[model samples]
Target: MDGPGHGDAALSAPTLTAREAGLVGCRQCTRVCEAADERCPRCGARLSSRDPGALQRVWAWWLAGALLFIPANTYPMLITSTVGRASEATIVGGVIELLHYGSYGVAGIVFFASVMIPVGKFVAIAYLAILVQRGHRTKPKHLLHLFEFVEWIGRWSMIDVFVVAILVALVQFDLIATINPGIAAVCFALSVVFTMLSALSFDSRAIWDRIKTLSND
Candidate 1:
């Protein structure tokens, strides 16, 4: 039999994972450390190759967010009271009203941020969580990119809450008209917060681990 050569081993060398190399990456700071270390030196955060309860936490928060999203859409987001008239408008209703008033730009923005973005985030988070849990190795890089995109866009999802706050503050008139945030504002804000928590609780390293497994195979 021919002796093992450099070319034969070279192909497998590049796929060696950090754990196999006797190293672990800090989850908080992304610093490489000896696997024996219990804590990250730089950030003082606990060191773990992967979060033990990541999927559980992600699922819990995701469920809460999904539940709250219902009321956020059904209940009124803004209550407008004038001298003798009153009206309640949910997020979609407010967007429609803005469109009817010919403020197309604002209407589109509200619809995109309030309706489209939140729904998209819920779906994306759930998808990422499921993929990571299943250890599905296909398109690992693309999945990581999707997770990062989800985290990056999370803050912007609060645009609706910000709009409600601004209107409540600036559109107050004692006798003429007043705009007040409704129950949906709280529900929507809570839903956004829970979804954000879910995204953060996910361990992106899980995606890479699956990639590493495939490469080794």
Candidate 2:
């Protein structure tokens, strides 16, 4: 009733080839086949997992982007001018202005889509990366839940980009309420994109696999 040993022969072990080795435990969910489902008993990938370094790289980008995002949100992202006089607005300031002007919908949307979501994504992704780097079994299940949340919120963090795009494209009426996106917008946009890429590139199975191997060793 016991399983085959690690290198034991005559047991017909499910060995993976070179290329397929990296994709060892990744199998269909059998219910809904998506980009996920790293474990599959039917596919014999249950023991095979992912690359541990992948999680470390993901965290590097995430933590760095989070650092950049702090300033991006704090600094002025838009400068508006009329009669050669200008007013600057950080993200929070812009939100408040919108609310003051009775643009509650715009303000609410900006606050959630841009401010809250980006910050939340950074924090969540960083935490997951840290957990994986620990490389120990009995891992926090909530980290997986947080990872799911990070994936779900990743795309929505591009609201700042959309806002900038719209402003640069539509607000071309010079001599009126002109809008020029500042340095902060570019940095913020890049932070969101890079963090998103980092999260997607990460492989959680790799972390767990390394942990399992080390623990076995």
lDDT of 1 by residue, 25-121 (tens): 7767878788888988888888876667988999999999999999999999999999969899999999999999999999998898888878888
Model 2 residue 21 distance off true place after TM-score fit, in angstroms: 10
Query: Per-residue lDDT tens digits of candidate 2, residues 1-217?
Result: 3555666555563554322443333434422222244555455454323454676678778877888888888788888886678889888888898999999998998899877888778767766666566565656455566777787787886786678778877776787767888888888888888888888867745544545666777
Best by lDDT: 1
lDDT of 1 at 147: 89
lDDT of each: 0.86, 0.70
Error of 2 at 128 (Å): 1.6
Model 1 ranges with Cα > 4 A deviation = 1-15, 214-217
TM-score for predicted model 1 compared with the true structure:
0.88
> How many clashes (backbone atoms < 3 Å, residues ≥3 apart in a chain or on different chains) does model 2 have?
4
Per-model root-mean-square deviation over C-alphas: 6.3, 9.1
| lDDT for model 1 | 0.86
